[model samples]
Target chain A: MNATIKTLGLAAAVTLAAAPAMAQEKLKVGLLLTLSGPSAVLGQHARDGFQLAMKDLGGKLGGRDVEVIVVDDELKPDVAVTKVKGLIERDKVDFVVGPIFSNVAVATHKPIVDSKTFYISVNAGPSNLAGKSCNPYFFATSYQNDQNHEVLGKVAQDRGYKKVYLLAPNYQAGKDALAGFKRHYKGEIVEESYTPLNTLDFQSELAKIASMQPDAIFTFMPGGMGVNLVKQYRAAGLADRIPFLSAFTVDETNLPAQQDAAIGMLSGSNWAPNMDTPENKKFVAAFEAAYNTVPASYAMHSYDAALLIDAALKATGGMTDNKEALRAAIQKAEFKSLRGDFKFGANGFPIQDFYLVKAVKRPDGKLQTEIAEKVFDNYTDAYAKECAPTN
Target chain B: MTATLFFVQALNGLQFGLILFLIAAGLTLVFGVMDFINLAHGVQYMVGAYLVAAFSAWTGSFGWALLLALPSALVFGLLLEVLIFRHLYDRDHLDQVLATFGVILFLNQGVKFVWGAAPLSVSVPELLSGSVEIANGLLYPVYRLAIIAAGLLIAALLYVLVNHTRVGMLVRAGASNASMVSALGVNIQRLFMVVFGFGAMLAGFAGAMVAPILSVEPGMGDNILILAFVVIVIGGIGSIRGAFLAALLIGLVDTVGRSFAPNLLRLVLDPAAASQTGRAIAPMLIYIFMAAVLFFRPSGLFPVKR
Candidate 1:
C-alpha cells in the first residue's frame, strides 16, 4: 500500500514537470495565398511583408516560436479549399492567414470559421463575411472589398466629376467594386463595362471609352491585366486626354513594368510607399533594403496582419490553444501598423484612413505612388453596420 | 466621329487577327504534318517573349534582340523536338497531349524559376515608339502597325516556302499522306524535324514581336494557344490559307462583337440586361462561331485533307 502511494506521487510529479514543456510547443501558422499564376506577384508581396514582420519579431510571435507553413492556392477557390483543409486537418495550424483574391477567401473562410481556427485575413475582405455571416474567430486586417472603391467614389464626388466611365473584370469582386463605387458617387455614370477576366487587349474598349469621352475613367484590372490596360491606354494616347482613376490597379509590384505609362494615373488605397509615419518609414526602409522594391498596399496589409498576430500572442503570453484568451487578446489589436491609426470595426474589418495617390516618377527615375490627399478619415466598411456583434 | 471610331476598331481587329495568324501558322503546320497535338506550342510563344525581354535587356537594342532571338528560338524548338517530342511521335493522340501538357507545366514553372514572377516590360524601339496617322483624323500606334506588316510579310514568305519550294512540296505531301511521302524516297524523320523547328520559330517570332506591347510573363501563351486552336479548326487543319482566313474572321468577330454587342442588344433588351448579356456574350462569340462552323461543315471551313 505504501509503495503504490509513492508510485502515484511520482507519476503526478512527472506530469507536472511535462506540462510547462508542452505549453512551450511552437505555434503553427498556415499561410494560404495564390503564389502562382498571373497574380503571383500579389501573393509574393504579401508573403514578403508577412515574413518581414516575422523577421522583425526575432522569428517569434507572442514570446513563442512560430512555424509558418506557406501553401499556394493557384488562385482557384477549389484548390484553396483543399489547401486550407490540409492546413487545418493535416498540419493542425493554430491560426491561418491570406488567400489574396476575394473568390478564394469566400470559398475557404467557411471551413476555417467552422473549425474555430483563428483567421486574420491579410488581403481579400469579402463583404459577405463583414455582414450577416461575421464570425468571431475571423478578423480582417485589410479593408472590406468595397472600401477602397468607396474611397474612389468619394474622391470622384469631391472632385465634382459630372461623368465617369467604370470598367472592371467581370468577376464577383468586380461587380462588388462597381456596386461600391455607385453607392457613394452620385454623378452621372456615362457607361459601365465589365470585360472578360483574361482579357489582355483593351483596344476595342479603349476606342469605346474614347468615343464616350467621360470626364474620368475608373477601372479595377489587377495583375498583368492592369499593366496591359495602363500601357495600352498610354499607347493609344488616351491618358493625356482623360483622367484615369483606379483602385488596386497601380502599385509597387506593377509600377516598374508600367514605367512612364502609369504616370499621372490617380488611385486610392489605404497605404502608399511615401506615407509619412515613423512605423511606415521604418517598414519602407527595411522592406526596400531587403527586397530592393517598395512594398505595396497588399504587403502593408500582410505586415499589419503579422503585427496584429504578434500583439495578440503577446497579450495572451503565446497561449494559442486557450481560445478565449487569444480571442480577447486579438480583439485588443495593440500593434503599430504600417498604415497609421489602424483599428478594427465591429465586423472585424479595418476602420482606417484611405488616401488618394498618384503614380509619379521619383527623382531617381523609378515609379512610386505618392499620397496626394486623404479620401476617408476613420472609415468603416458599409457592411460593418449590418454585422451583429458576435464576440 | 462614328466613321473614325469604326475605322480604328476595324484596324484593331485586323491587328489582333494578324497576331493570331502568326501564332496559328506554326501550330497548324505542325499538327497537319506530324499528326501530333502539341499543347506546349503555346509555351514556345511564351519562351519567345521571355527570350526577347532578356536579350533586349542584355543588348539594349530591340533590333539586335529581334535578330538574335530568332535563331535562339529556332534552336530551342529543335532542342525540344530532339529531347522529348521525337520520342512521342509514334504515340497516340491522347499520349501526345498528355506529354505536351506536361511540357507546358514544366516550362511555365521553369520560366518563373529563372525570371521571377513579376511581369517584365520590353520598351518599344525608338523607331517604332510613336503613332502614325493611318486614316483621316485617326491615329494608331506604329508598333501595332509594324506587327500587322510583319505578320503579313511572314504569311507571304510562308506561302512561298510551303507552296513554291522543293521542301515545301515534301511538307504538303507529308501532310496529305505521311506513309506515301515516306515511300517517295524522302527522309520522313528529317522532314518532320525541319517542319517542327520552323513552326516553333514562327510562334517564337510572334511572341518576340508582341513582347513590347504585351506584358511578358510566364503562362502568357496559354490563352493564345486556345485561340490558335480555334483558328486552325476554323481555317481547316494544316492549311495556312485556311488558318489565315479563320484567324481574321474570329478576330473581327471578337473585337467588333465586343465593341457593339451591348448597343445591339440594347435595341431589344433593357439597358442593364443588354450590357450584362453583352459582356457575357463577347467572349463566347468566337467559340459560338467555331461551333456553328463545325456544325455546318462538320470538318471546318477549309479542311486540308479534303
Candidate 2:
C-alpha cells in the first residue's frame, strides 16, 4: 500500500511538472489589437471572436493545443512596436495577429514580417501593405483599407448624387478612405474636411456642411467619433435634409451608443450581421451567444483569420516549420469564410464582395448593421496591380 | 456667406468654451487652494459621465439621471479625497502627479471593469432634443444652446461665489498662502476637503452635462483634461476669472481656427496643400497661444497676489 501511494504521488508530480512543457509545445499566437480607450470595443470583439473560434475548435488549432497572448496596442504606434517586439522575441509566438487601426499595423508590420513569424492581419489593411510592400509571410483576411469606402463612392454615383462633402480624420487611413471614394465617385466635391483624430465635436464641420448644402455627406469617423458625429448630425437636423453616406461611421461597433440617431444611416461594408450565409449565420449566432453583442467586420475578419490559419495548418499536416510550404498552404487554404466567396488576391488581401449596409434596430431590440444591397462582386483592391504575385 | 459662417463658428466656439470653463473652474480651484496636482481630476469627469449614463439608463429620464448623478459625483469626489488624495497633500508636486496619474489609470480600468469597454450613450433630454434657427438659414442644436446657457449660469454663479462668499474668500486666501491661512487658526484641512470636493463636483457636472452629446467611454476625459490644463495655465494658476476668459479664448481659437485655417492658408498655398497644412496646424493653435501667453506673462494672466 505504501509503495502504491508513492507511485501515485510520483505520477501526480510528473504531470504537474510536465504541464508547462505541454504548453510550450502548443501553437503560440500573439494577438495585438487596440485594446484601450473608445476603440477598445473593436479589439474586444476581435478578441472575443477569435476566442470563440478557439473554443469551438475544442481549444485546439490545426489539431494542436493552442495558446494566445493578448496585448493592448493602446492605439499608440510606438507602444505597439515595443509590445510586438516582446511578443516576437520573448514569447516567440508562431503567428502574430492583430491591430484594428492602420497606424499600429504600419508601426508593427516591418518588425514582425522581418522576423520568421507569419503575420495575419485580422483588421487594418493599409493601402501600402496591399501594394509594393506586400510580403508572402503577411496575409490580410480583412479587405483592403479603401474597398469599403469605394462602395459608398459607387453608391453615391449610382444614386445620381451630384455633389458630396467628404470628411475624415487626417491620417493615412483617412486619406486612403477619401481617395478610394473619389476613385468611384465622379461627382463634384463641395469640400474635403480632414479633422484631427478623436475629434468628438463636429458642429463646426456640420455648419460647414450646412453652408455647402452638398447632395450627400460622406465621412469615415469610426468608434466614438462615429457615435458623436451621428448623434450631432441628427440633433443638428441635417439627417433629415442631407443624405449621410459613410464607411465605418455608423456600424455595429458604435451602433449601440448611436441608437436611434444612427438608424437609417448608410454605410459601406464587406459584411453585415444580417448577411445570409451558413458560415456567417453560424458566426453571428455563436458570437452573439458568446459575447452578447453583434459582431462587426473587425470580429468577422479576425474569426476568418483563425479559420485561415487552421485550414492552412491542416493542409500542411500541422507543420509550422516549413516556411514555403506554410506560405503556399495559407495562400491556397480553402477555408469557408463568414463573408461569402472570400479569396486572397495577388496582394494577400481578400477579394470579397462589398455591400451597402444600413443601421437598424432589430426586432430583438439590438442595434446592428444589415446588408441593404450588394455594391460590388468579387471586388479586388486596385493596389493589387502594384504588387508582384508571391507565387 | 463667409461672415455668416464666421458668426456660426463663433457661436460654436462660445458653446465649446463654456464647457471647457465648467471643467477648468474646478481644476483651477483645486490646484490653487491645495497646491495639489490632481491628474485624476479628468477621471473624476469621466466618472461623472459614467454615473449619469448608468443612472439615465436606470431611471429612464435625463432629469432624474442628472439629479442622481450630481450628488453621486459629489460623494464620489469626497470619497476619493478621503481615501487616496488625503495622504498626498503633503507630497511634492511630482509625487502628487505620479500618484494621481496612477489613480487615473486605476479608475479608467475600474470603470471599464464596471461598465465594459463599450461606449455608452445618454439620449438628449426631450426639452433640448432638436435644432432651432439661430440665424437666417443657420440652424444650431438646442441641446448645444442649452449647454451654453447652463455654462453661462454656472460661470455667473462661480464669479459670485468666489468673489462674494466667505468660503470663496477663504479659498482665495488659501491659494495665495496656505501656511499663512493655517497660522490664522482656520481649519485648513476642512477647507481643503471642501474645495477639493467642490472642484470634483464641478468637473463631474461638466462631464454629466456633456454626456448627452458625447460618447461616455473610458479615457474620454483625457483629451479634455489637457485642454483644461491649458485653460488654467493661460488663465492663471488660481484665478477663476482668468480660467473663464482663457477657456473662452481657447475655445474660440480652436473652433474658429479649425473652421477658417484652410481658407486662410489657401491664400498662400494650393487648395489641397492648404487644407492639409491647415488641418495639421489647427490643433496646434491652442498650444501656440499658451506658449505666447507664458512668454509674455510667466505666472499667467492673473496670478494669485502672493
Candidate 3:
C-alpha cells in the first residue's frame, strides 16, 4: 500500500512538471469585488474593466483561455473571507483577485496566502499588509490605502491650505484617510465630518463645511454617496469659494451623474483615463468603444491587474497548473503596464507613479481628467520598506 | 453660523426627521401592536420607490405614479403579513427576528432580481424643480418644503385616524392588549392585515416622497428602519405621537451635531482630534438619544400597554 501511494504521489509530481507542456488550456482567475449594497458601482466598474482587458488581450491570456469567477464581498470582511475561500475551495480558481475596501482585503488575505494561492489586489491597500504581512503571494495593483491621501496632504501642505475640512464615509477607509492626512499635514484643520457609510444626504454636512469656510475641503466619499455629495455641493453653491479635493469620489463612475458639476474638482490617483501612454490610450479607446462608457479608476486598476496576471502567465510560458513554477514566473516584472514600466516591490506592490488630476470640461464637451501635477514618478509606498520577507 | 446655513440645516433636520417619522410610525405600530419583530419592513419602502419609478415612467406623471404605488405597496405589505408575519405572532422574539431576517434577505435579493441592482431616481416635476426662498438668501428646495409640509399633514392625519376614527380606536385597543381585543370578537386576522398593510403604505410614502431627492436602490429602507426602530423604542411603540417627537429630536440632534459638532469640539480639543472625534460621534447622536430614553423610560415614552 505504501509503494502504491508513493507511486501515485510521484505521478502527481510528474503531472505538475508536465503542466508547462500542456499550457494552452483555459486558466481560471477568481475575481472578488463588493458587488452589492453601496459598493455595486465599484464592482460593476471593476467587472467592466476586467472584461475589457480580456477583450484587449484578444479574449485570451498567456496563449490560453482565461475564465473569471466573480463574487460579491458585500463590504463585509468575514463575508469576503468566506466568498474568497469558496472561490478557492469550491470553484478551485487558480488565483483570487480584488476587494476594493482595505478591511475586506486584509480579512481574506490569510486564507488565500495559507492556501498558497496567488492573490492580486485591484484596490484597498492596507498599511499592515503592505508592511509586515507582505508575502510574495500578495500583490497590490492599486495604490496603498494612505498613498493617495499622502499626496493630497503634500499638496495641501505645499499650497499652505490651512483650515482644511476633511470629509469621508464612516468606516475603516475613512479613518485611514484622515489618519493619513494627519501623518503628513501640519496645518490647522477646521473641521472633520464622518457621515454614515452609505449616506446620500450631504447637504447638512456641506452646510457645515461651508460654514467653516475652510481653505480647502478634502473628502473620500465613494460610489453613489460621492455622486450625491458632488451634486449637492454644487446646489449649495460652494464652488470656487472652497476648493474641493477628494479621492475615489470624483471619477468616471460619478462623473456621468455629476456632469458639469464635476468640472474643476481636483483628485489624486495612480492612473487616470487620459494617461497618454500607448497602452492606456488604446485601453481607453477600446473600453469606450466596447462599453459606450469611459472607464473609471476602479476599472483601470482592475484591467491592469488582469494584464499583470496575463503577463506573468506568458512569462511562465503558460504553465499555471504547475503552481510553484507559475508563482515564480509571475513574481518577475513581465506585464506591459499602462502606467510605464514599474516592477513589483519586495512587498508585491508595484513601484508606480501618482498624479493629481483636475476634473476638466474638455472642448469635446465631456467631463474628463487632465493631469494637474505629477505627484511621483515610479514611487514606492511608505510601508514597503518594512516588508522584509526572510527567504 | 450664518442665518441661511442655519435655516437650511434646521429645516434639513426637520425634513429628515419628518421623513423618518413616516417610516417609524408604521414600524413602531407593527412592533407595539403585533409584538412581531420584522426586518423586512425596509423592502416595502424599496417596493414603493420602484413602483413609483416604474409607474411614473409608464404614465409620465409623478402624481399618478404615487397614486398607483400606494395601493401596490399596501397590497405587498398585506401579502407579506399573510404569508409570513401572521405565523410569527405566537412565536418567540428570537424566532420572529430570525424569520423576518430571512424575509429581509429574500426580499432585498428579490428586489434586485426584479428591479436590477442599479439605483433609480424619480424626476421632480417642472413646477417643483428649483429652490424657493424660505428666508433671505436661504433658498430651500421647494420640493423639500413640500415634503415637510406633506409629512406633517400625514402626521396630523395619522393622529386623527388613531384618535378620532373607529378603526383607529380598535388599533389603539389592539396595541395595548391584543388578547382583550380578540376576546371582544374583533376579526384579529383582518386587523393584522389592515395594520400591516397601512404600516407598509406609510413606509412606502416616505420612500416615494424622498425618491426624487434620494437614490431609490435596494435596501435603502434598512438604514432608516434601524433609526425608525430607535424612534419606536424612544417614542413608545404604538404611539404615533412618540414617533413624531423622537423622529424630530433625533433628526435635529443628528443634523445639528453633524453640522456643528466639529466646530463645537474644535473650541476645546485640538483641531484634528476634534474633527476626528466629531465625525465618529455624529452618527451616534440619535442612538445615544434612544439609549437615554430607554434608560429612563424602559417601556418607551409612549408605551402602549401590550
Could you say which candidate leads in TM-score? 1
DockQ of 2: 0.65
Off by over 4 Å in 1: A1-23, B133-138
Please, what is the whole-model Cα lDDT of each candidate in the order they appear?
A: 0.89, 0.90, 0.81
Q: Return the candidate ranking by TM-score, descending.
A: 1, 2, 3
lDDT of 1 by residue, A1-391 (tens): 3433454566667797665555456789999888997789999999999999999989988877889999999989999999999999999999999979888888988999889898888888888889888888889888898888887898899899999999999887888888888888999998889888868889888888888888899998888889999999998888998889988888898898999999989988888888899989999889989998888888888888889999997777666667978887888769898888888777888789998999999887878899999988998888887898853
Please, what are the lDDT tens digits per residue for candidate 3 over residues B174-213? 8899989999999987887888999999988888988777
Which ten residues in a row are the worst by lDDT in model 2 chain A? A1-10
Native A-B interface contacts kept, per candidate: 0.63, 0.81, 0.35
Which model, 1 or 3, shows the larger TM-score?
1
Docking class of 2: medium
Q: Residue B174 of candidate 3: its Cα lDDT? A: 86
- The regions of model 2 sitting more than 4 angstroms off are A1-25, A78-92, B265-270
Instruction: Give candidates' CA RMSD values in order.
Output: 3.7, 4.8, 4.9
TM-score on B-chain, cand. 3: 0.96
Candidate order by decreasing DockQ: 1, 2, 3
